[model samples]
Target: MNNEVIVTCAVTGAGDTVGRHPAIPVTPQQIAAAAVEAAKAGATVVHCHVRDPASGKPSRDPELYYELVDRIRASGVDMILNLTAGMGGDLEIGPGEEPMRFGPGTDLVGGLTRLIHIEQLLPEICTLDCGTLNFGDGDQIYVSTPNQLRAGAKRIQELGVKAELEVFDTGHLWFAKQMVKEGLLGEMPLFQLCLGIPWGAPADTGTMKAMVDNMPPGAIWAGFGIGRMQMPMVAQAVLLGGNVRVGLEDNLWLDKGVYASNGSLVERAVDLVAKLGANTLTPEQGRKKLGLIKRR
Candidate 1:
């Protein structure tokens, strides 16, 4: 447990959060701006997801990804860019009456197509969701089979970009260990313990500890919880010898009736980490710690 913890802010996720939160960044400009703000407020890393400019729905558009990454780089914030390669896997089953026919909201794609943006941009780090699960409030299934994950990991390795392993459940963690054993991971693997997602690991001390205990040896890991559990998990993660992540992607409100800005969420996490007698890592320090070589 190092005293210095790297803080990552997942600024805006690619969920249906536009109408729900007035501050959910939509366009490339908005997303980049939010990322810059998060970096300035003490986030060493920024996890990103793009959305359609007009409809505000999640998009796999390479153009959008390019614009967003370009803007963040141009902003001069210098945060580690972590693009999401977790899209194009949404499956909303159709009526049982039409078994073979796919239903609405089924946007599944092959591995290469899903990670088209990562192939082009080659950010310092990109996400590789380790496993699939029943996702969200709907009956949607987020499919990430072993073969799909292997292909994605191979592509990420080909680009020489670090993969941020996102583990949503215990089974996901087990599969991640398998990847490590198979040598799919790099010298210093990076992981993110995503707690409190629907039908996944619950956001509690016991569950968090269990997940942390299961982390493969020598892996750099961070933990975050959703909604009201955001700040609490920040403290828990730090005390339990892991890094912390925060932002509107996992939480909408900063307090009882207060909607939070990305910067505010980051500031709160920084304060908590510092108060716990742990220092926070800068983007450069974080990159070094995570074994990510800066893209010239």
Candidate 2:
């Protein structure tokens, strides 16, 4: 088990979770506030995804991201910022024989287009989903071809922003290492093992351990699971010699029937890590550990 851990709170995801919880941070202001709350509760990093203020739907507008990051910085809260570059890859296929007609949920775009916010905002870290998957129990799929991933990884490296390679399955992990081998990624790569998301890797002890065992040497990695497996994975990740992630983006409840705020989830994670004889690292410590140079 790691003696020190970095706790990352994914403030708001692009999932359809709004209105399902009392506080899901819809607008930029709300999202920023959630990040600050998580930081105060002992989160070393905040993973953010902006949403439409009016409709509470996921958005990829750079303006919204700018405002969110700006608000967090202006608050004077010390936390490593991690932006999601996984948007703009949603492909919602049409039902039945009209497969050519994409559904309204589709927001597919080129690889670089997805990084517009990252290029402009230049957060300390941004995620690069290593591969695609059948995202959910629908016609929707998250598309990230190998070539597109190569281009995105290269651009992120050029921008001097740390790329958090998000691996959802063993194949994704394999391709991520390939990118490193191809020199598309920089030294000391960061990875996030995503589990229990619909049709991705299931949140099982063996599955997480297998992924952890396959990570490249000298890499900084974190792991998280969705829904009820969130807290369990925190312990699993820490005991398996990696960092941990927890937030409303992955799970909504603090207990069986209780809804959780971003801060509360982080607070619980801090306690869990402490119970396991590991202390949560500060943002500065996390930066040093991950080899990240703070920007702005």
User: lDDT per prediction?
Assistant: 0.90, 0.95
Error of 2 at 12 (Å): 1.0
> Any runs in candidate 1 off by more than 4 Å, and if so which?
96-100
After superposing all C-alphas onto the true structure, candidate 1 shows an RMSD in angstroms of 1.2
> Tens-digit lDDT track for model 1 on 82-185?
99999998888766676456777789998778889998899999998889898876567898999999888888888899999999999999998898888887
Residue 30 local lDDT, model 2:
95
Lowest summed-lDDT stretch of 10 residues in model 2? 212-221
* Clash pairs (backbone) in predicted model 2: none
lDDT of 2 by residue, 24-102 (tens): 9999999999999999999999999999999999999999999999999999999999999999999999999999899
